[model samples]
Target: MNPRNILVTGGAGFIGASFTHYWLNKFKNDRIIVLDLLTYAGNMSNLSQCYENNRFEFIWGDIGNSDLVESILVKHSIDTIVHFAAESHVDRSILSPDAFIQTNINGTFSLLNAAKKVWIDTPKENNQPVIKHRFHHVSTDEVYGSLLPNEAAFTELTPYSPNSPYSASKAASDHLVRSYLHTYGLQVTTSNCSNNYGSFHFPEKLIPLVITNVLQNKSIPIYGDGKQIRDWLYVDDHALGIELVLNKGKVGETYNIGGNNEWTNIDIVKLICSQIDLKFAENSYLREKYPQAFAALSGDSASLVRFVTDRPGHDKRYAIDASKSESELNYRPTKTFEEGIVMTLDWYLTNDDWWQSIIDGSYLETNSKYMII
Candidate 1:
């Protein structure tokens, strides 16, 4: 099926924005429509460059809005759908599980129902022709629960053992997507990705959060000795993985996307601190004027590390076995952890205003003020 027009949900957020921009360039001939709720995490500015393209359209509405989604299907003739819209921040999910359940679980249900109407009602050209509709759902590796340090990574057939409100909600949605494929004969595929870091990232996330705080001479909070481990994948690579799965992947299958780079909480923070120090203080012109500052910051970068109360239900470790994606979909991560950290650090160092606005009053945690780095 040649999908001339496609609809991408949550295209205004971090990974979503990257996906939207990536796809527009990858498939220049196809038109793309984006739907987002523009919640605290969603910002239209992420996709502002694509706004003027005649092939791109955005609707500022929630996926849970059945009437709105159904209308969009009719208006755009969108045959391919890439679903990324959700309440994604784990911290926020811990604070308010209600919002995550509403958007992640219930919203997915609404999207499936709306698509059934559009795909089922279309008049058939001939009995020999199969339905050309495609539904790609974006998900996370957290749904597989924590892993031991040397444990094997998660695969396509891993059991659902989500530990937090955020993962649990995503688990439910993943089930719904799979059920639709089997029961209603909906064409669907899903990808569970590792931690993503890159440009246009929200401040609440770890990479941006630590980078922002360090720039302001603030303490970098480390939860529970900072021992938790995660596989960090660059957002652009992740965006590419999603497109690969949607395009060449088998229907009714789940794929894992991992960069094969693993780091503990402390190591990631220290790596960013070292990168920032070397880039700004030693590598740049400031080396001449602030040689002492460079030595002090680098030698004692650990001073900024502060062990804070751990998050409730925090997973000790997470890893993804992405061999399926690598072999079948020809997917591979383009960025290493070291290179990705430098890129992330440079972005925060350069773009202060973007993250500063998010760390202001309402979103600021109580510990955000008192820590010293």
Candidate 2:
């Protein structure tokens, strides 16, 4: 296959960064231009290793900026766009829905509009072969909303029943992408993934939050009995899933990407706690730095678990049915929950400076030479 020039929005964020690394490592000749808004969740250090690669370029910008989006597309001769930028946290959306609406809804519209303008409406280079451009949208399973205890997992045909402002915004964005594909004939594919956990994950999310709280000796907040269930997908597996979709998925189709590993909120916390306890037991040096951690003492890490009032409009459960992607794209998640959790725990334990900087608000002060568009 010929090398493709790809534009990746939100490539500095967790899942996007993972996809960026996966793509660059696998497709060495392809060039990638990352466009991110550098919001609180966007960590430049996540892509620090990519700086040395001549094929990779980082641009500090927003997907909502149509002019910048168009400029990058035309300038780089981009043939593929992997859209991942959005306001993703449910708690933050409940407190402030405006950012969610603007970023998730309007921002997606801007990207679609810019792609249509440049890739479809504009004139192509003289004597050049027709380039097939693709627009891949990364979405979350929350758009399917809560499921009853025995309800089947969400499929591609699942009717969206978004409960929170965050999910509503994402649902709307998903619709916008679909419209562009049907209305303007833009090549588009969407993947709705289960909860992703791995390195460079913002500490605000559940997995990272629990891991960091344990390391810091802080209370691990479990909302409203903590029975909320989510299917966990390792970030790398999600990246691989996207790669399959981009390479083989049909145009104008949506695929569900899941790990098929489901666990309740409280259960997840307990698992992390036990893992940390084992880590502390095996490594004596951890006790010195995290002296106050529950495991560092002779106490169960579960002792730090605290039950907090649940957020408004909390979804009771979310599970994905990735059979469509599995059969059609021949995709499957390689990491089991056990292997993924162990890897995630080791990442947090070893990379103190990474998460520590985020906790102390030092990661935001990124003094770098990456171009800011």
- Pick the TM-score winner: 2
Candidate 2 overall lDDT versus native: 0.91
For residue 266, what is the lDDT in candidate 2?
Answer: 95
Ten-residue segment with the worst summed lDDT in candidate 2? Answer: 122-131
Q: lDDT at 81 for candidate 1?
A: 87
Candidate 2 error regions (>4 Å):
124-130, 367-371
lDDT of 2 by residue, 1-373 (tens): 8899999999999988988999999998999999998888889999999999999999988888899999999999999999999989999999999999999999999999999888887644454533579999999999999998799999999999999999999999999999998898889999999999999999999999999998888899999999999999999999999999988999999999999999999999999999888888878888877887865356478888999998888899999999999999999899999999999999998898999999998887782445355
- In candidate 1, how many clashes are counted? 0
What would you estimate as the lDDT of candidate 1? 0.83
lDDT of 1 by residue, 1-373 (tens): 3647888998878998888888888887898898887777777667779978889987778898888888888789888889999998888899889999999999999999888767764444333444478999999999999998889988978898999999999999999999999998889999999999998899778888777766666778889989999999999899889888877899998999999988898888888777767666455553443344433355455477789999999999999999999999999999888888788776766666567666773423322332221
All models: lDDT?
0.83, 0.91
User: What number of backbone clashes does candidate 2 have, counting pairs of residues 3 or more apart or in separate chains?
Assistant: 0
